[model samples]
Structures are given as structure tokens and as C-alpha cells.
Target: MTVDDIDQELLRLLSADGRRTFSEMAGEVGLSVAAVKRRVDRLREIGVITGFTVKVDHTKLGWGIEAFTELRYAGATPVSAIITSAFAVPEVQAVYAIAGDPDALVHLRVRDIRHLQQAIDRMRRTGPVVGTKTLMVLGSWNRDDPAPGPVSDER
Candidate 1:
């Protein structure tokens, strides 16, 4: 489906706040409410708007630690098998099969350091996992947020 400029603007607004009302979007984009609704419906019909989701603070929900574990598997390990092994551990949030030395990268959220270590151990023990390297997340920034302006030094 071809997404025109108006469609692009609608998408950006919806992505920033999924619960934003159609009327508000219509006002922002200079279109009638019904027109905005129709455009949005068309976007969904074409599968561009697959679904809406809520972003949560994992730290507030008792998940104090977040980490990424790079997994190296045997030469013959299938991608599906790797995904299955990672998903078996409940803490595994996302699994990315990449094209490099490490076969996959697994995102995990856990309650504490001990929980993180346990999840890593579980992954290591599963399937044809040859090696695993985990990196702890200290902070993160999303592109959706406004970028900081250039730094200046003057006194």
C-alpha cells in the first residue's frame, strides 16, 4: 500500500500516542474526523497498522535488570530451534537471529543479578548452544525521544 504524506503524518501521531482520538488527529492533520477514521481504517486493512501496544517500565514492575545475551550455536543449529530454546526461558523477551559470529541475540528482563545469571545458565544448557556472552544494560534511549541539541561551553 502506498502511504501518502497525510498517511505518514497520521502514522506518526498514532505511534506517539496510540490512544490519541481520531478527532484530535483530524484536527492536527486538517481533515474531518470521518475522513481521518476512513484513512486509518484503510491503513489497517492494508496491514500497515498491524496492532497497538502499551510500553511499560520493566523496572517499576520488579524487573530490575535487563540484558542481552549473544548466543553461538553449532553450525547446523536451525533458527527455529534457537528461538525455541530462548523462548523456553520465560524471561527471554526477544530473540534476534543475526548474520555473524554469534548466531542470535536474546533480550532478557529479570528481577535481579541472580535471576539474570540463572536465565543465562538455562540458555547455555539448552539446545546446541556452543558459547554465550551477556551484556548488562545500564541505560537506554529511543530514537522516538527528542535528540539533545549540540553542547556549548561558555561562561
Candidate 2:
């Protein structure tokens, strides 16, 4: 439950690249390979490290547009219903139910502007959605990137 400095370092390395070997992590953390493995295993057993994921370039995979749509529900729409409506559209990558004028925000990846419009239309028609405003992403930077720019520095 308590992650120490070394465990945090290991997590940072793994987040940057899930494929990093335990041996490499050991060298970075100044521990033996077996020790590093044991620590990583414990991290998983205690649920600190639930799983690993791969970073993808959607543009390379034919999804050329990424957008975020703010959704406004009519009144008292259940969170489950909001999630269900967004998930029903395959282009939706994630949804956030937040505390604001807009009840939810949906992240989507689509082939083009027309596809984005269609996905947004579906979101409105599926649930108690009363309104939606979409903003196209021109560029993005993630801290999980192995070699990120100056904006990623938290130190």
C-alpha cells in the first residue's frame, strides 16, 4: 500500500516503457534483478501496479482526428446512462463525468470531421444529452512519454 522512493522510480520507468526488463529496472534502481522482481511482484499483488498498457499513435492507424466533446444532459441523468451513451459509439475512447455546466466530457478518435460529427450526433440521440460542444485536438503531450519535452519536467 505504501510505495517508497524505489518503488516510485520503478513505476516511473515502467510507465515510460512497459516493455522494460526487470534487469534494466534493477540497474536504474540500484538493486539486484531478483530483488527488483520481488518488489515489482509485490507491487502487483497489492494492486499498485494493476496492469501495463501500450502507447499508440492513432494517426498512424488511420484515426486522423482526435476531439473532446463536452456533453450537457437535460436533468438528473444517471452516471451509468452517460457512460453507456458514450460507449455505444465506437469512436469514443473515454468519458469523464465532471462537476460543471457540462455533465460529461467525451474523448473521441475518428477518421475525419464528418465522422466526428456523426459520433457527436449519436451521443446526443442516445441519452438525455441536450447539448454538446466539440473541440478538435491539434497537438498533445503526455508525461508518460519516454522522451518528452520541457513541459514534462516536474522537478
Candidate 3:
């Protein structure tokens, strides 16, 4: 898709609140509920709108430890193998294959530091078992700051 101004506005509204009703969005975007629905459907069909999900407080869920681990593997060790190993451990939230000294970066959220260590040990044994470096997060401000304004003059 080729998104226009109205489509952008509709997206902005839905992003702020995914469960927002089509009727309410129609009122804000100056379109009928059915028209708005069509546009949203098209967005999903084209893969612009993937899925909706709830944001949770990890601390409240008893998951206190958060860390970033840089992993290096011996030459010829497939990245896919490393990713599969990490995925087997539930604490591994995301895995990024980078283009630097460390071949991959893994994001983890676990019950505690000991839990994190256990996960790391498992992954180390599963993959090429070359080396690893981990940095535990003291704190984070993932959504504390107000986002900046638009870059272009589109608005």
C-alpha cells in the first residue's frame, strides 16, 4: 500500500488504541464505519497491519531480570542453529543477528539472574560454544519519554 492522509490518520488512531471501534474511527476520520473497515482490511491484506496485542508490565508478572547478551560462534556454525537454541529457552524474547564482532545479540527477560544464567548455559551448550558476553540492565525507560514530532512536512 499506498497510504493517504486519511489512511494515516486511521492508522494513528488504531495504533493509539487497537480495540478502538470502527464507528468511532469513522467519526474522527470522516468516513463511514464500513469504509473505514474496508481500508483496515486492505491494510491487513497487504501486511501493513500484522496483529494486535496487549502490553504487559513484566515486573508485575514476576519477570524481573532483563539482559542483553552478545554471542559469538565459531566459523561455519549456522546462525539458525543459535536462534533455535535461544528460542527453546522461553526467556529469550528476541534474537538479532548482527554484523559486528559479536555475531548475534540476544534479548532476555527471565524470573531472576539465576534463571538468566541457566538459560545462557543452555544456549552455550546448544550452539558452537565459542564465547558470550552479557550485560544486565539496571533500569530502563522504554516508554518514558514523549516521542519527537514527524520528520517531514507531511503533517
Candidate 4:
């Protein structure tokens, strides 16, 4: 599915704020409401736009503790199995099978230190994970932001 200028503009706008109405988006992108709706529908059908979600505050929701865990697996071990197991645990927020020194990097949010310990213990028991190094998140200086694309002078 090739995305044209209008589609790209729609995506940019939606990425900034997913909750914007179709009519509102149409006005900004200089397209009719129905046309905008059709483009969005097509984008979703082609898997360009997956789904919308609401961002939440983990601290406010009582998940105060955050940790980053790096797992080193055995030689030529399949990391997918480990990742699947990690995702099943409620405390796990994100899992990445990195290419460098560590086999996998996992981000977790827990209610307290005890919960973090339990999560680590469970992961140790899971397949092929030889060792893990965990770092407790004290404070985040920067929040996660999507990579901005190249500047265009279409407008």
C-alpha cells in the first residue's frame, strides 16, 4: 500500500493526536470528511494503522517501580520463547531481543521491590536464560517519543 501526501499528512496528524475526529482531520488535510474516512479505513485495512490506545501514568496507577533487565541466553538459543514468557507476566511492559552483547532487554513496571524480585525469579526459571542484570529506574529525564521524520515543505 503506497501512502500519498494526504495519507502521510493524516498519519502525522493522527500520530500527534489519535483522538482527533475525521471531520477535524479533513479540515486540516484539505480533504472532505468522507474522503478522509475512506483513507483512514483503507490504511487500517492494509495494516498501516493498527489501533489507537490511551497513554497512562504508571506511578499514578500504583506501579511506582520500573526496572530494565538484560538477559543473556545460551548459545544459539531462540529468544522468541523467552520473550513470549516475559510478555505473559503482568509486570513486563516491553521486551526487546537486541543484537549486541545482551540477548534480550526487558522493561518492567512493578508495585514494589518484592514484586520486582518475584518477576526476576520467574524469568530465571524460564527457558535458556542463563543470567540477568537488572537496573532499578530511579527517575526518567526524558519520556519516550516517536522518531520524527524528515522535514517536508509540502504545505
lDDT of every model, 2 decimals: 0.92, 0.91, 0.85, 0.87
Query: For model 3, how does the per-residue alpha-carbon lDDT over 1-155 read when each residue is reduced to its tens digit?
Result: 59899988887888777899999999999899999999999998998888887767899999988999989998966778878877887888999887777988999999987899998998788768689999999766543233655556546
lDDT of 4 at 129: 82
Candidate 2 stretches greater than 4 Å from native = 150-155
Against the hidden true structure, what lDDT does model 1 obtain? 0.92
TM-score of 2: 0.92
Ranked by lDDT, the better of candidates 1 and 4 is: 1
Instruction: Pull out the clashing pairs in model 2.
Output: none
Instruction: List candidate 3 stretches off by more than 4 Å.
Output: 139-155
Give the residue spans of candidate 4 off by over 4 A.
Answer: 138-155
Query: After best superposition, candidate 1 residue 138: deviation in angstroms?
Result: 1.7
Better of 1 and 3 by TM-score: 1
TM-score top scorer? 2
Per-residue lDDT of 77-138 in model 1, one digit per residue for the tens?
98999999999999999999998889999999999999999999999999989899999997
lDDT value, candidate 4, whole model:
0.87
Q: Give every collision pair in model 1.
A: none
Q: Candidate 4, after superposition: displacement of residue 14 in Å? A: 2.1
Best-to-worst lDDT order: 1, 2, 4, 3
